[model samples]
Target: MDPENAASPPAGITREDLFERVWTTPINHLAEKLGMNHYQFARICEALNVPRPPAGYWQKKAVGKEAPRPELPAALPGDHARWSKGTRLLAPLPKRVYRRVERKAADRPQRPARHPMLIGVDESFRKTRTDEKNEFLRPYKYLLPDIVASADHLSTALDIANEIYNALDLKGHRVMFAPADQEMRRRHVDEQEVPRKDRKYGRYQTGSIWSPRRPTVTYVGSIPVGLVLTEMTERVTMRYLDGSYVREDSKLVRSARPWQLTHSWTTEQDLPCGRFRFVAYCPLANIEWSASWQETDAAGLKSLVPSIVARLHGSEAELQALIDAEEKAAAKRRKEWAEAQERYRRQEDRRAVEQALSHSKKQLAEIMEQWAAATAVERFFVEAEKRLEHLGEDRREHIQSRLALARAMLGEQDPLSYLADWLAPDERYQTRYPDH
Candidate 1:
């Protein structure tokens, strides 16, 4: 009988039939069968308010198990709703009650404080030299590389601040900037002063030069560059340091590489008190060593203390000797550990090989037993065929069916592979035998 006409469809041909047919058939074949282009078929489904097939659905179905059909609800009598309402109203209150309880715990007190070091970076200065007329000077036109180089110096200062911030973990700390002098402030401020219109210089008015307009400067309170550095420093410090909080006594140090601190300006004549311009004093001894920024600034006038000092002072030779001893001890321990691991690995390999051999033996025995049983049945069939040489053709077919059933009982015949041919060959026999 034709499978299509085996039974009447429960419902009329609708979107569901289209979905099943479209889903079961390959897209190219389905499109050709419907006499429509692949894209047009998809559009038709959309017009019919049906969702299009998901990408790779065909490929997935080729490898996946058939999706289970949903169970339908049983038919109910007309009076079922009334009976349900009465039964539900008479039912006892549910005993399963969920209760949540709140518990109060005592808060712990703070412990003794630990010392953490405090570090700070000074405000950076930007110097731009202008022409005699006070107009903005272009560095390339004037061959004044120093002006461009000054920007690099500011960048170095910022980098130093970042390194300090990252090393110390000062994520949320505030960085305050105080300009060295009023001249520096005027140069940095965005807004310039303008003269007021009302004032005029006169001999009758005590001969003071006055302007009507007053100088006004605009102030924008943005988070300062130094504050950003401090916040980053706090973050880094918290990440590496122990305890919930940090204190000022933790050793703080900074070092400047490639630049030396010196006096930017000096007084022409010696006097009782003379102003000195402090700069980074980087001597050869300070190279590659971490020191404080504050110390570097003060190194010109005084001998600055070393930043990274151990608890005990020792000669370079003694320190090297200690390091060598520790390294030798570590090497010896590592050698011993390696030997232990090698022995353990060898033992595991032996055990694995033994287990594999045992499993393979068991599997070979089972296979041999099955082969022997199959050979015996084939011999029996040969003997039965010899004895039934005079049997009718119908009797031969019945005997053949019995033999097929016997082979199936012995787990020899695969129905899906041999009879239905529904499953792909690779899927059916990919793992016929287990790995040894």
Candidate 2:
């Protein structure tokens, strides 16, 4: 049967029809034809129990090598069963949620002098400027990988950042700046590794934390995970003196006189903690998800990299669910905006006709009132002239002069002129709509 004639299937696409289309075209390109993003389209395939071409399947097929195509499974009772472009359920097929797969940690004969993400990073993080109050590094370059630290911890921060980036590379997770073509988001990786809510905000905001123009992310298959390695903040007592803040226990504050202490006050603030933390988060703007591991007593943050990667390696299903829900909500929002625009347009069209009709009625009543007033004035003048005939010549002459002034005040009244300028409802507003 023609796919367009499929009665129960959405968008007139049957299960077999969708299966052929996915295999025939790369899923990414196929998404545009169906008016859905790649993830949304992938989800639809999953719902219909359709098997798709694996990554490199098309590449291999292009080289004339046989690429295996999996058979579509028999429909399950809960399956979406069929789909077409019009279907609301776009499939985000994260076909397999990551399972922890262990492999030999290949020892590089020599690790590259540095991972590309870390090249020139040390010089780039110079404390060219800083907030004296917190002593935070305000690097001139904000477009570095999301590694935030201080001058003293720069070397240690690089080592941990290099290790995680390279290790993920060896494990087949491509860690780097997010691809421009992908829709990705970065969580504000604060200087402190603490929960974002608990992290204190201040005038300097712990001094401008470095952020990359694009997020630093890794793709495990089609899933993109964001990474941030930052030094956590420590709470300490700060003393405000004549002009600046200094550590309460510092030499300057400790050397203060009794009189000086009387004017000074101390308050607790978050300074750069010597410790570091690694955070992994879902980088979709519509999704809120993250996991973090900071320096522990027994281990440094470097040792925690593998566990962080492993956790991301396993949380695929959870992130996929969040992404799918967001896609559906976005579609709903677009639909609502379009409906609101149409409704408003209809209301404006109807309002224009009503306003014109109301204005015409008001003008008609005004003209009739003016004509009555003009008749009254004309009769008064006529009656005064006849009464003057009965008075003496001297009295008539004086009264006639006053009547001339009154006529000037109400001069040139004509109902014909008002009628000529009058507009009917049809003339006032010529509607484009069909007549009722």
- Return the TM-score for each candidate structure: 0.24, 0.58
**Model 1 worst lDDT run, 10 consecutive residues:** 226-235
Q: Model 2's lDDT to the true fold?
A: 0.74
lDDT of 1 by residue, 70-145 (tens): 3322211111111111121111112323345455455754321211211211111232332211112223222111
Q: Quote the positional error of residue 401 for candidate 1 in Å.
A: 8.6
Maximum-TM-score candidate: 2
Q: How close is each model in CA RMSD to the real structure?
A: 35.9, 12.2
Task: Tell me the deviation in Å of residue 57 in model 1.
Answer: 72
Candidate 1 residue 377 Cα shift, in angstroms, is 1.7
Error of 1 at 330 (Å): 1.7
Return the clash pairs for model 2, or none: 42-91, 42-93, 43-91, 43-92, 43-93, 44-90, 44-91, 185-283
Worst 10 residues of 2 by lDDT: 90-99
> Candidate 2, 372: how far from true, in Å?
4.3
